[model samples]
Target: MNADTPMIDTTAMQRIGGQLGTNPAGIFQDGNGRRYYVKTLESPAHARNELIAAKLYQLAGAPTLTYINTKAPEQIATEWVELDKKCIAHLSESERKQAQQWFAVHAWTANWDAAGFNGDNQGVVNGKVLTLDVGGALAFRAQGDPKGKAFGIRVDELDVLRSDDGNPHAIKLFADMNADDIKQAIMVVVQIPDEKMRRVIIDNGGSHALAEKMIARKADMAGR
Candidate 1:
C-alpha cells in the first residue's frame, strides 16, 4: 500500500456517488459497501510528487489513506472503509467522543502546532448526526503552502473526513492542494478520460473549470 506499489485498473470501479467539484477523481461505494478510488499519474513529475506526499503522510502515522500502487498505468488506489448508513445517521454520543479523540490525534500529528484550529464539528453524516468532516482546522491564516510543508497534514485531515461532506471536503482539499502543488497533483488528474462530458464547475481560481476543460478535450479526442 505504499507509493512503490503498482496502479490499478480503476476504470472498472463502480461509481456510487456523483462527482465532486473538489476531487474529480472521487469515487465511492454506498454506505453499505466498501469504497475504492484509483488515481493515475498523468505526468511523471507530478506523480512522483503526489507519491512522495502520500508516503510522507503515511510515515507520519496520519489516518489519511492506504496508497496501493496499480502500476498498470501508473495509478494509485486508495482505501474505502464504508460506514453503515444507519450507523452514520444515529451517531451515538460515544461516536462523537471517538470523533473528538480522533480529532485530537489528527491535530497533533498533523502539526496543529503550525496550523491553527477550527470549531469542534457537529458530526453529521448523510444529513444526520454523524461524524461528518473532521479536520478542516486551518492554520493561523490561509497563507500559501507552496513547498507542501502543510499539505501532508491538511490533505490527510481532508481524506479522513471525506464521507462527512464529500463536496465541501473536495473543495477545501483542492484549495489546500492548489496552495501546495496546483499544477502537479491537483491539476494533473484533469487527464481522466470520460470526465469531460460532465458540467464544468467554477471555483478555486478555475481549478474545476480546468478539470472540465481536460475532460472536454478527452471527449473530443474520443469522438475523433
Candidate 2:
C-alpha cells in the first residue's frame, strides 16, 4: 500500500507470523481505529484470488471478515474481526443457519485453502461463525482436481477441492443446505456487473484474462 492510502494506517501494526502462513502479514489499524489483517503477498494471482473471494463473501452477505481492496497487487487486506476461539460445532438455530450460509458461499467461491469449520480460521463473533484467510481460493487448485471448473456444479457432480481437510461437521453443514439456498449464494455472486468486475480486477493488478475467465464462469452459471 502507498503512503497516500488515507483509510489504512500502516504505522500501528502487529506482526502475525506463524499464525497466518509464510507470508509477511500483520494486523493494522484503520483511520476509524478498526484493526484489519493485511498480508503482503508476492504473487498477483494469489492476492487477486483472495480479494475476489472476499468480494464473493461480501456479496453473499455471509458472516465473514470484510475484505478491503488494496492499491498494490502484492497486498491482501481484510477487516480483522474479533472472534472467540470456539469452533462452529455448537450453535443456536439462527447461528447454525448463518454457518450454513457461509458453507454455501465457501463452496461457491471454491476455496481450496481455508477450511471453514474444521481449520484454524474458524471462530465465533457475536455468536456467528466467520472464516478468514482466502489466499488459496478462487483460482487455486487442489491435487487431482481438474481444471476449468472454478465455479458452479457441473453435470450433477461437484469437486471436493474446496477445502484442504474438510471435516464431518463441515461436510454435514454443506450437505444440509438445500439447492435453493446454494443457488441464492451463486445468484449474489453473479450479480456483480461485468464492467465493475473488470475494473476491480484491473485496478488490483489482475490480468484481463483472469477477469474474462471469471465473467465467463459467471455467465455460464447465470445461463443455467
Candidate 3:
C-alpha cells in the first residue's frame, strides 16, 4: 500500500486472519506485488454473486471485476469478461489478505451487515493498497426511515475508478421502488469507506437520508 494510504494494522489483521480460516481462492500477484481474492469464509454463491455483478458492470463498459465462477479443475471455461481497464480484476494472495483485513475492520466499524459489500483494491503500484474499487453500500436491506421498511437493487455508474493515489471511487446507479427503501439504500452506498466513492455515487445520481422508521427484512434465498 502507499505511504499516504492506510495500511492494515498488525493486531487487527491477526484477529481477522484467524477468522478467515482457509485460502480457498488461489493466490496470484498484481503488478505492484499485492494479492487479493474473495474471502474463503464466503460461500461460493456469494462469491459468484459479486463476480456476476462485476461481470454485468464489465458488459456495460464499467470498471469492475473479470471474475470467474468455476473451480480449478474447470479453469478452462474461465469467461472473458472484458471490462473497462479500470475494472479489471487483480488477483494476488497478498492483495487478498490485505483486502480481507480491510473488510473485517470496516465490517466491525460499520456494522451495517455481515459482509457490507466490502471489496479490496489490489491496484497498488508501490507497497500501498490501491483503491481500485469502492466498497460498502448494499442493494437492499432496510430503509433508513425509523418507521419505513423496503428494499431495492443498485448498479454503479461509470465514473468510479482507481485513482492515481490508489483510492477507489464510485458512482451508484440505483434501481428499485419504495421511496424510504431507496433512501436507506442510498445511505449504504454513500457510507462507502472512501469519500471519493461516496462523491462518485452522489455525482452520478444523488443522495438522501431515510425519513421513515428503519426496518430490516429477510433477504431472499437468492441472496442480496
* TM-scores of the candidates in the order shown: 0.35, 0.67, 0.27
lDDT of 1 by residue, 1-224 (tens): 53355445556456765432122355644344656655433444334334443332333332344555544434445664343432222446554333333332232223231112222123333323322221222221112223234533224432333223433422322223322333232222224323322322221112444334334433332232
State the TM-score for model 2: 0.67
Misplaced by over 4 Å in model 3 are 1-38, 72-224
Alpha-carbon RMSD, each predicted model: 17.0, 4.9, 17.2
Per-residue lDDT of model 3, residues 1-224, tens digit only: 11243322222222111211122323332344443332332343333323332332232233333343233321111112212222114535554333333321222112122121222233344433332322222322211211112122212111111111222221111121234533443344333334443333333232322101011111111123
Better of 1 and 3 by lDDT: 1
Q: How do all the candidates rank in terms of TM-score, highest first?
A: 2, 1, 3
Order candidates by lDDT, high to low. 2, 1, 3
lDDT of each: 0.35, 0.58, 0.27
Give the winner by TM-score.
2
Q: Which stretches of candidate 2 lie over 4 Å from their true place?
A: 1-36, 40-44, 68-73, 102-104, 141-169
Q: After superposition, how far is residue 11 of candidate 2 from its true place, in Å?
A: 7.5
